[model samples]
Target: MPAGEVQTDSIVRDALNCGKQVFIPYIYGASKKGTTNTNIKSMMEMVKLNSLADYESLQRDRWGIPAIDPNTFDQREHVLQTSLEKGEGLDIIFVPGVAFQIDPNSKLVKRLGHGKGYYDSFLHRYQTKFHSTGQQTSQLKVPPLYGLSLKEQYLSTDDEMEVPLETHDYLLQGLAIGDGTFHNSTS
Candidate 1:
């Protein structure tokens, strides 16, 4: 297996083994590709976990409560909405990226994703709701947003990257390298 996948698998095993519920972003619509939760579960079973679910199910199914088919949701918006209805909050949000940068001052980080703003949009919308209700949003808490990548896919600082960020977009909490290295944000 590739080094990046090795690192991701290790971190995932650690997270799940430690009983830390993880929320992995799943792509919706026609642009989707790559391994689904089934594949993740197959891998997880290697380490003795039962199953894996999308963010929607993970949020709603606290204490191993099983959720319905996650495919019924329209998008990340639906996931967030349903989660709120279930009286649950997001704990960890695992995002995939090609590259990311850590801000020096706020210790904030941004991931350069597939050039689409799905993750960015979802976060912005949810944060707006949190702000309107005066509720503490997880986006502000610097939850671990690990980026999965292959070794050859790594980009250096000189790459002149354009990480999507709205005016109210929340930065990532930390970065997990493909080598199993977790880099925390330091302001």
Candidate 2:
């Protein structure tokens, strides 16, 4: 992983070692109908990683992040599929971002991504698909989003810097700082 990005190999190892189900983002170009949509050229879904060995065997992308092979896309189990069939969604998501900040007034976490909108889109899709199936929100839970970032990625709260966010942006529930500190937003 690059210095700019938080290393997640240890997280993956720990989760796997604990016998937790682990999923990784798989980005591709497809529409809601499951057809190639080269026009927009971006859609993301979390695909299950069977084991730490599976993660270790994956190839890294240009950003030096491990990416699943396209040939195995059809064979892998999607997080959405599990949510839909088993009625169990993720417990938490460790979000990655270019920058993050806490809104002073609202006490909510805000994340700035790499401009791809992949994470936002996937979360929105998950909420819509999983929760809209005529089930109680309690029965079908939406996972709390927690950002993972280095200390440098957090904007200076001392200086009162504001993070510019749009309506479509999803606010994070908490933050896991690389320096071994955690920040949870009251909102």
Candidate 3:
């Protein structure tokens, strides 16, 4: 789903209820290709800040208080690390992007995010952490990562572009549509 229509409140509530620490990648501007900064601020408020005023104060004055930036590797790493620490490890990540697809073989989902490769970098780091801890096999039980999308943007099998195999493997999930439609390669 477009970040604007993701129903962040609902997703956050669900994750919190399930004892999942939610890490949402917030986008910066009109790119409209990832979770917008506004949405991220809103989510922080809903989950940690407790109020708009609290969020504003933190953003306005907090030095080194991680902010989202798709192009900077250092910034991305810092944000991921900070979120992981706050949540005790990212159990669920709400990614934002323009398009996504499911790969039947790898059972992975691919999201067409912005040009920066922030998502890819974050995923790589996360997987590395999982692997280094020798929990890769056990952690693999996490279901296919679901790519949120809007109804009108759904692509059919006949779509011209083939999602790269590497991208598919990175996600190893499925796609979720805004109108309650869920598509999976296995399905």
Candidate 4:
């Protein structure tokens, strides 16, 4: 809420205006040790924005990211965990990246993060856990990871950002970059 320049528009406002649930990242642990956890679904609480003031009323942490109060959301529903339940799973995730390298054939966007592997860790574990139970039944839809960046940060097939990737690193290629969305990464 400080300045929308980094993100441009209030995606939260638009989503909430349409009666959609908005989940911001609930980050924990220490990033200095390379172990930051973002429970974007379970830990993250949905905001019920009655107006623009509701969005403005949200608080920000030291990192300047908007946060929601857990006490405000309903305790009965676990949106992230329930993604794999009822024959539906995480449909879409707006993965943040400093830059991206798209695989030629797969077109999946590998995130060049801010030297921290938090998203990679969470995505890897989420996919593995979701697959363990949902794979056999053909009921789970692993959320397609996407990213948006300024056109200046866009990397062509030739450019390499040299972001190191580990075995646990998730290669998320599907992205709804800017105004484009496609189905190729997850099913």
Give the candidate number with the greatest TM-score.
2
Q: How do the residues 45-95 of candidate 2 rate in per-residue lDDT, one tens digit apiece?
A: 999998889988999998899999988987888987765567667878888
TM-score of candidate 1 to 2 decimals: 0.53
Q: Report clash pairs, candidate 4.
A: 83-89, 108-173, 109-173
Per residue, candidate 1 scores C-alpha lDDT tens digits across 148-187 of: 5554454445566645565645577776666555667652
RMSD (Cα, Å) of candidate 2? 2.2
lDDT of 3 by residue, 106-174 (tens): 656666664456666656656565555544344343224567777655555568876554432356356
For model 2, the superposed segments whose C-alpha errors exceed 4 Å read 31-39, 135-139
Tell how far residue 160 is off in model 3, in angstroms: 3.9
User: Counting only residues 3 or more apart in sequence or on different chains, how many pairs clash (N, Cα, C under 3 Å) in candidate 4?
Assistant: 3
Error of 3 at 81 (Å): 5.1
Q: Estimate the overall C-alpha local distance difference test score of candidate 1.
A: 0.49
Better by TM-score, candidate 4 or 1: 4
Query: In angstroms, how far off is 5's CA in candidate 2?
Result: 1.3
Q: Extract clashing residue pairs from model 2.
A: none
lDDT of 4 by residue, 97-130 (tens): 6766666666666667654566765676666767
- Give the range where candidate 3 is weakest over 10 consecutive residues by summed lDDT: 41-50
RMSD of each: 10.1, 2.2, 9.4, 6.0
Cα TM-score of candidate 4: 0.65
Q: Between candidates 3 and 4, which one is better according to lDDT?
A: 4
Count clashes in each candidate, considering only residues at least 3 apart in sequence or on different chains.
0, 0, 8, 3
